[model samples]
Target: MARLLSELISFLEALPEPRIVMDADYRIVAANAAYMREFGAAGGLVGRRCYEVSHHFSVPCDQAGESCPLKQSLESGTPQRVLHLHHTPRGEEHVAVDTTPIRNEAGEITYFVETMSVVRHSSSRPAAQGLVGRAPAFIRMLEKVMRVAHSGAAVLLLGETGTGKELVAHAIHEASSREKGPFVPVDCAGMTETLFESELFGYEKGAFTGAAHRKLGLVEAAAGGTLFLDEIGELPLSQQVKLLRLLETGTYRRVGGLDCLSADFRLVCATHQDLRAMVAEGRFRRDLYFRINSFPIHTPALHERKEDIPLLASSLLERVDRRPGRRLSPAALNWLQGRRFDGNIRELRNLIERASLLADGDTVDLVHVQEMAEDLPLDLSASAGDAAGEFRVSGVQPLAELELAYLRWARRQQPDDTGELARALGVSPRTLYRKLRAAGA
Candidate 1:
């Protein structure tokens, strides 16, 4: 088997496009010559994990927060496709990826084939490369972000604490024209007035008691780029006036400095708090709120997009565990679909992380998931994955009687749909009806 798998290395190396074969453990088992030219050193790829060479991350692409087509294909037992922004030698480039699963003789997925094509269009770059969502609200939000990103507008992100606002902020920056510029993020929460001034505007030498030399502030660091002020509602009234001055004038003076310097940077702000209410309560300055709120983008909370949970969970698990063949069983998925993820994406990551550790083998089952759930305070139940046996009889019955009994059981679960019952038993609806009628069931 080892020699057989090694033989694939030569065949893969001949492909025109960059292609790699990852084993169930996500180790790069083989890479073609194009792949070597594209992203490798031409040797020692066989032992390295795919994420290390491609993403420079310690974890899998899904866990490192990129939607992974490799993992997606493994689970579906079919080809999967995704658009990604990969860090190439030249810079970030848009790549369309197609993944196909390779199954062993016993029909178990053992490896994946990943082929990547560079996408040329700018508008089609997925706003957030790894952020997974299919819900209507999520799609709407993504569309809005994509549209707003290209323009040099001040974007205000609003969402619950765990709703992934920073990811949205970065997406807007990535999709915008200034993607090459540095994206400097500032957390405004609990920053003292002195700290705010020093951080946003650099202090000249001898300007302050501890200032031994001139320091470059975040605003200057983000020149010709983006300056993200997260939790802007936390800015004190005194600091708000100073930020307003900078935004309005497009200039700022260093802390205790003599000259005014230009701050050529795009502004983006985000917070879970209601800035409008803060303004109404006289906590947040009205003018600053208006300056940053030119284009408001709201990230929907997890519950609002329940339909996306399945993909989200799959993506998160793939991110957490990269053991090539690890999978969330159909039963486990049925259980996860019914969860109310209060912590949103972050909380889901925790659940999967813990449950993955509890689960053994490639398939994470109902028992493993339920065990994790019982230990946590999360509200969940076993009703989804639990299966009540089809056999109501105490002893073995004839094959005919067994078929009729199982068909009857399938009917109770599917209820009144001949096609659904037939699907459950892997039989044609006509055959299902004929058997039931023959058995007087």
Candidate 2:
């Protein structure tokens, strides 16, 4: 028996899934290599209770009621299965947990075995395709994605257009155990109302016009992986009902096929529009909105988090211009900082790409930036409300007073760094500091 158990442990260790063994008392007895690699530094897990290591809970695993598979198997002498959300020792994020039981002599369960699958964002292995920026907002969103990636719950990614909601969804898939599976993306806006059902659930050969062949839907193609529905707000009301039904039962029938097929895939939806408002306007189903919003993440807009502009600009420039020593000049960066980017990160990236092409040398100067800016429609509406009322550069508002107001606004937008402001107003750092002091900022 001892020899057999030793061999089992070795095999479990070699398995790609994270595996851990817990004794009858729910105390962790052994953990495999994959488990340690997934959780990071599982040394302290030994002798600790399963709940302690898996959930950071101080109590017994059964404290959450009799639904615990480990306790159920120990009591009933029957194999059990359960899903759990577990945090790793290094506090990386939550993982999808699966638990089973190992029996000994007399058919009594002696140890509980747990398996974990780490979720990932996308199947793309390119290191350069990682989430951009180290800003607090960006990091916080990444952490949220990691936490919810493993669950069966639907995720709603809310952000302005071009905030990379789709990228975040891919990151969630990549971080999950489903990394080996396919990641399929569906653009809801592109699907006509009449074709929505067939496109999403797929159709059988001769199901409808142009249904030339049997096909696997995006959901089926993403089995054991992730299905990303972009612009979900654009989904027609009729399709919304079908989607909601599938989400509820995990069952669907291919067009022209009577047999129902079930698919197991994680769902991640993204949209630039306000889903809540759409629901109120009768354009979207309220129930569907609630269903997908189970785990919601709001991506920060570029203008709302201007402090990250420099990093974003630099990253965009590197992506567009791979030339050696390519860099943005201080003057050009200042102009970018002062101007409100109405189109958000996408617009900024486009501008940088154009500026890089127009730049004569490796250094992108203000002239190149200005040339690009000239082509862009003036964003007067962006600053109208804040700079228009009682804060204008005319009348009783002296140059110093105007500077103070602008400084205050600038500080609010880009705190912790005045470099952008200095460049925007075309002043030396020392001069900007003296002016700020004079204005009592």
Candidate 3:
């Protein structure tokens, strides 16, 4: 048994990724050079608990509300994979963990071999580019992205309008085997049949009127890489058949050319619309839906992961605010966290951009953000005198709930303009929007 364990450790040492062998009790027995260099302890790692070394946790990861791959592998008797935020030497980082159970000759599970890899395309902390999230929903979605990144499977991203599907698609492309190849994005929204053909399949000179030169289509440009089709639900049904034929045959022809050009690119489609329902309603082709739905990943909406609001807002402020040393005040962050964003990340980014523009000093305060929210278009037709009545509520309720209810009632009286309603209610427009969203109005 000792010799077998030694051999297993030696074999893991040759691998590039960080690998560790631990007992069933989660004590680190052996670690490869990669593991030592990446997650080295002040004292040697051996004899230390894996959870303590990696997560600084007194208990197992599962006890800490994280999925424990070791516990999972023990139950399934197979490999288990999970994404975890690990405490690294630099800082907290998003790490993908794969654990396999090692059984002895008696068929009893003896040890576990765990491999760790850091996610480069994303960050647990705020990042300047790529994905920035630490919420459970974000991790769940990222786990799916990592699983399908190395494969040739067609990817379908489904989410709300501003859920950052295109960014997810780009992350997939960057992580995939075709990282060196071009990543071409084609917006399917409002794309005409003629444009779809010429744009996706390229066009020969004189293929149509005003054809001055031959053009390379998006599919051909993305050779050996990924082609992202954004908002594919908006694509006209008339053009869907042509796209289906091209995908099925793996070939296409120029507008005026006769020779069929072979397409050599991975397909990734995204939509805020439900393609299954579209198929049921005869609005989308079932065959094409199946083709692109090989590996579907859900991009979580901002509201679903509200815990990441501060991180997202900080990162977005960095991206949008050109003024160096500018930052959001704590009050501003608090206000942002309490507000609602129906347009998700995009809406949050716009708010930050507008606030940045309005802010003159280094720090953008709550008033700056509130002013931006107040600038929202309102009906402004109803007068404030319409809301001059006593507000009443029955039954026991939380103070916050009561406040939100009162805001809703006040909103109904002055339904025309939220800015005017805020003045009448003696609250800021930012407060009005937050309470309104909480009230589900």
Q: Clash pairs of candidate 1?
A: 13-32, 13-33, 24-324, 25-324, 62-319, 63-319
Q: What is the per-residue lDDT of model 2 for residues 1-441, given as tens digits with 9 covering 90 to 100?
A: 576568778878778888888777888777898878768554567888887766667776568542477767777766665444456554444344556777776776667787776434321111234556545466556557766866767899999998878778888787777888988999999677657777778889998888889987777888889999999998889889999999989899988999989989988999999999999999999999998889999888776666667767777787787574588888777667656576888889899899899987879988988788743322222243343334333233235435556665555454556787688768888887886665445
Worst 10 residues of 2 by lDDT: 119-128
For model 1, the stretches where C-alpha displacement exceeds 4 angstroms are 1-129, 322-325, 374-441
1-441: candidate 3 lDDT, tens digit per residue: 798799999899899989999998999999999998987778888899989988999999999999999999999999999999998887999899999999998999999999999989898776778899999999999999999999999999999999889999999999999999999999999888898989888889999898889998888898999999999999888999998998899999988889888999989999999999999999999999999999999999886787898899888988888896688999888667666576889988999999999999989898988888742322122233455666644334447646655655677787778898788778899987887887655
Count of clashes, each model? 6, 18, 0
Supply the global lDDT for candidate 1.
Answer: 0.76
TM-score of 1: 0.57
**In what order do the candidates fall by TM-score, top score first?**
3, 2, 1
The 10-residue segment with the lowest total lDDT in model 3: 375-384
- Give the per-residue lDDT of model 1 (tens digit) for 77-176: 8998766556566555556577888776678887888987654323122222356665657766775677687899999999888887887888788878
Model 2 vs. true fold: TM: 0.60
Candidate 2: where is the Cα deviation over 4 Å?
1-127, 322-325, 375-441
Question: TM-scores for all candidates?
Answer: 0.57, 0.60, 0.87
Which numbered prediction scores highest in TM-score against the true structure?
Answer: 3
Question: lDDT of each prediction vs. the true structure?
Answer: 0.76, 0.73, 0.87
